[model samples]
Target chain A: MFDWLQHFADWLIFTVFNIDAGTKLGTALNFFVYDTIKIMILLFVIVFIMGIVNTYFPIEQLKNYLNKKKLYGLEYVFSAIFGAITPFCSCSSVPLFIGFVQGGIPLGVTFSFLITSPLVNEVAIAMFLGMFGLKATLIYAFSGILLGTIGGWLLGKMNLEPLLSDWVKEILKLKMQQTSYQKEQQTFYQRLPEITRAATDIVKGVLLYVIIGIAIGAIMHGYVPENFFNQYLGGGQWWTVPLAVILAVPMYANAAGIVPVIQVFVAKGVPLGTAIAFMMATVGLSIPEATLLKKVMSLKLITLFFAVVTICIIISGYVFNLLL
Target chain B: MSKVIKVLGTGCPKCKAMTQVVTDVISKHNIDATVEKVEDIIEIMKYNVMTTPALLVDDTICIKGRVPSQDEVFTFLSNNE
Candidate 1:
């Protein structure tokens, strides 16, 4: 599918630059150019479609339905599915999280949503498809959903209601009925401009990370020995999954920024599971997100949330290693 | 009576942009509406909005989940009256 891109990168590097394609510099620059453009194109197209889908999606209606139903244990899965589709910025998570809780959804269900929202989305899926392949992306998407469900269900079982901040506790005590808003009717043409602008904004937001990530990927691709990572991360060592997750927890980068690096890791013999664990940890758990959650949760609740998610991600890493 | 325009968001970039556009519309078109940024989570929840950057004119939600252009804001304000 991207054969033309590969040829273009070859022509640009070998003919235009007059460099030996066999050289490390030539190889690295070629990779850098091809991947950055490819990922950017994929990102724009996917985000544009997602923007339109988001505009038409009946989130208010869905929330009302979820509120009315007693989904038994399925609410956790429903929340994870909902989280996967909703194009929410982490910065707005607090309001969204609080809103979900106020609507009488279980804390665990909301937690399931929160856990999966950032980890699996259209953008991440597109990158995975472009970089890895269909099989890996499918595995990633499934694991992300399962991780959210199991983690949230476990958290829900903990009876952590007391861990909510007083403000949220007070709100919970009110038991206010959920309010419904009227849905606006608009033709697709009427909504095109807004959707286009949103798509452009998303592309602009992640362009830099894509460049940096691809650059590092290029460097690793050209200079690093193919067997370099095998010694450490190659085999399915029991400790590597947890180690990767732990190392990634302190750092935060969007999927676009991390996927390229992971691509290189897998190429250089890093186990797929370990690399995926690293990518999920980097994007899913962040200090900033923790700080944001602190506004509504006590220290204990926040810690518990992070710990549960971390352990779940580690398990996912192992599952990927075993399956793939 | 002045129309009450409440912009509900938790200060995300889109929310801020929504506030800016609404403010610009009120000044450029001289719409008689007061703009309030509902940043508090508790207050935002009261509106039953699932997404931020929601525009409420006289407590009627005109937009949610996306920023409206200046012209859209103008139309929303004028139509509300």
Candidate 2:
């Protein structure tokens, strides 16, 4: 499907630049150009389509329904799926978190939504498909949902309601009614400009990270020895998964930027599970997100949330390694 | 009719942009309105708004989750007035 892009990269690198195809610089440049173009195309299409879908999506209605119904344990799955589809930014996490909780959604269920949201979304899916192929993308998506479900379910069971901040508790006691904003309905064509602008803004926001990520990936693909990661991060060592997750906790990057680097890690000798776990930890459990959560949650709750999620990610990493 | 317009956001760039747009619109129209930027999460939560950059005209939400274009802002202000 993307043969033209690959050919273009080839022609540009070898024919136009007059570089030997076999040389490291030539190979790296080719990989960089091809992957960058392919990922950008995928990103734009996916984001644009999602923007359209979101325009018509009754998010307010859905949140109301989620609040009223008891979906048994399936709420976790529902939240996970919702998390996956929604194009969320970490900047909006606090408001979204408070909204869910105030809407009477169970705390664990809200956590499920929060956990899967950052880990698997349109940008992450697009990059995964472009770099890792369909099979890997499916596995990654499935694992992300599973992690959110189980992690959220467990957290819900912890009876941590007492850990909420006084401000949140006071708000909860008030039981504020969810405000239903009347959105003006417009035809697709009328909404097109706004949707297009939104899609463009999203692309612009992540472009720099994407470039930096792909550059690193290109260098690794061309210059790094094939067995370098395998020598250390390979061989199914238990510590590697935990270590990867631990190392990733402090580093923060959106999925678009991190996916390329993760791809290179897999391309080299690093275990797929460890690479994925690292990506999850980096995206899902961030210091900034924790700080944001501090508004509604006490220090104790924040610590517990991070600890629980870290353990869940590490476990999922091992499971993926064992199964795949 | 002097109105109070509150722009609720957590200080993200988009939020800042939304505030800027509202400010520009208010000045351009010479509308009788005061624009208040709400950056506090607890205060924003009182409005029960899940999305940031929500434009509230006299405490009634006109838009949320995205910044309104200048014309949209003008329409909102004129309608409320």
Candidate 3:
């Protein structure tokens, strides 16, 4: 992938410090610089493209499509696939979920979208590709999407719409208000400044987190003994998977911020499966997201949702650790 | 004279509430202005706004990260106008 970045970092380190770049400290320093620069460039370029796509992808069409679907497996698949692309925030997805429910989308289909949208997004893809290489990146993306699809399917089969909170049911009865917008046509020529501006905005938002994550990673890279975690973490161990999932569920962060830290974890000999499971849990599930989901779902249903995702993630972590 | 008021957001609830506030202020004053909701993340960034529920009056950033009251929105409009 970005082998050039390593060479560049090596040159910079050797030229500045007059030290052998292959030494332990130099290698860690080079890793930090290479990854930070790579991720920064990736975030800017990918986010810019995503912004443009978001502008052209009409929300109305997606809603209409979800509303019209009647088949079970096909609808779930379509919803999960669409959800995989639509980037989501902890709070933003709630209102959109409300709209979906109000539009008469089935419980399971909507859940599929909500669960998959945040977990399997493009930003994560770019981060994984840059940090974990192609093979691992593909495995991560595939497992994430598959986990969402299967989890949603199983939940839907349970027919638990009655478990929705009373307030959610009441809102469904009321006519959802649609906000109309005056058309604003923009050409590709006009989008140049907009793309740069968006890239800058996104960088500004995540820059601090990214720096902190990378800093922590650099420290770990320098200080941790190689394969220091063999006894504590391995596929052969049963507790490692659940331990990773439990540790990851409470702390939430964007993929851009967390991937740097995960890179260090993998370097520190965290099992590939456990590290990825942690990534999915931290990025996909969070307290704020749970609080928002609570507004529309009963305590029981919320518990069920969390439980399902946790189990799936733990299973993935253990399976990958063994296979890889 | 007319003005263009842009609400920069990702179409979240806070963004929607701010849009409603701006809409109400415009109607109450009967102001001769065009209100546009910039829901596209890319479009919203043209103003260098990092946070949502941002109010931009005629290309100048007014309020960001929170919804201003209708009275506050009125002041923003009147001052800009």
Candidate 4:
């Protein structure tokens, strides 16, 4: 088993590093630069497109339309789908949340949006496509949407509105103060500023996280032990999935920054599901995002959100392992 | 002297809340202080605060982890004065 693992790690390292038995150091440096630039440019394009989409779409109208009484399950699914398209992160989602709530969109549907917005962002989608190909990217995106919708529906069924902050409730109460006339009077084109503001805000907000995440990924690509994960996290170990999730909890980074790391892990024989789960947990449920969320959500709701998302990622990880 | 109260964050809700709270507290207390929302990471890094919603008073990190309560703000400014 040890020798097989070592061989696997070596194979992976060679494939990822693009190094032959006797490749020069300059070749390796060249490969790193080429990969990093390609990845970064892809990220920039995707984010820019997402920004344009976010800028052009009128989410408030959509939220209002969805606010009507309907089947909870379907609403949750649609919420997640909508979230996937929106270019907002957790921070940028705040104004949208406020808009949704004031528009009378159910808490659960809003939760779906909240969950999916950060989990299946454009940057992640682009990175996944770049590293894992279109099929894998599509799978991850669809799964994220599924998780977001299901999670939101579950939370909505719990009827946790009473648990909301007094301020939020107050905001809800004053919803009527701004009449629909005030809202409908503004066309989608007129809302460009708001969309631009949200896009720029999200980019600015997550830029550091992305940069740091990518930098870490670059270093891992360059020097982290190839077999480190296989030695520690492989072989259907009972502790592996939970341990990966726990380890990922305190880290505050983005998916784009971590994709290269994920590639490295997969190269080294780290279980596919475990690696993906670790990535999801680290990127989606970042410590900083959680800490920032605490200002808006109560401890109870936050804990529940965390638990639901963690379970989903774990299950997804296990499923990947089972299938792949 | 202008009492400087800095709200540290990358322009998230908590940072916005901290800015509001500081503004509210200063107004309520009628203190002659200016509240500046610091969105630049470098400026925030100078204070060595990693968390958002950090509150700094005249360069001292008054609150590092959580949003300061109204009472806590009162005591902090009072003590500083």
Error of 4 at A287 (Å): 2.8
TM-score, per-candidate, Cα-based? 0.94, 0.94, 0.79, 0.67
Ranking by DockQ: 2, 1, 3, 4
TM-score (C-alpha, index-matched) for candidate 3: 0.79
Give chain A TM for each model in order: 0.94, 0.94, 0.91, 0.79
State the lDDT at B16 in candidate 3: 82
Q: Which is better, 2 or 4, measured by lDDT? A: 2
Q: Which candidate leads the pack in DockQ?
A: 2
Interface RMSD, candidate 4? 16.8
RMSD score of candidate 4 (Å): 11.9
How many clashes (backbone N, Cα, C below 3 Å) per candidate? 0, 0, 0, 2
Over A128-190, each residue of candidate 2 has an lDDT whose tens digit, in order, gives: 888888898888889889988988999999988899999888888896866556566445676
Q: What is the C-alpha RMSD of each candidate to the true structure, in Å?
A: 1.9, 1.9, 7.2, 11.9
Q: Tens digit of lDDT per residue, candidate 4, span A187-228? A: 555445444554455456556665555555555655666677
| lDDT tens digits, residue span B29-56, model 2 | 8989999999999889889888777898
Better candidate number, 2 or 3, judged by DockQ: 2
lDDT per residue as tens, model 3, A1-324: 578888888888887777686687786777778888988888777777766665455555787887886775877777877777665444456656766777788787788887887787766776787778888888987888778887888788888889987866766676654433324334666556644665576677777777777777777887788777775774367888788888877667555677777887787778788888988888777787787677678999999988887888888887888888
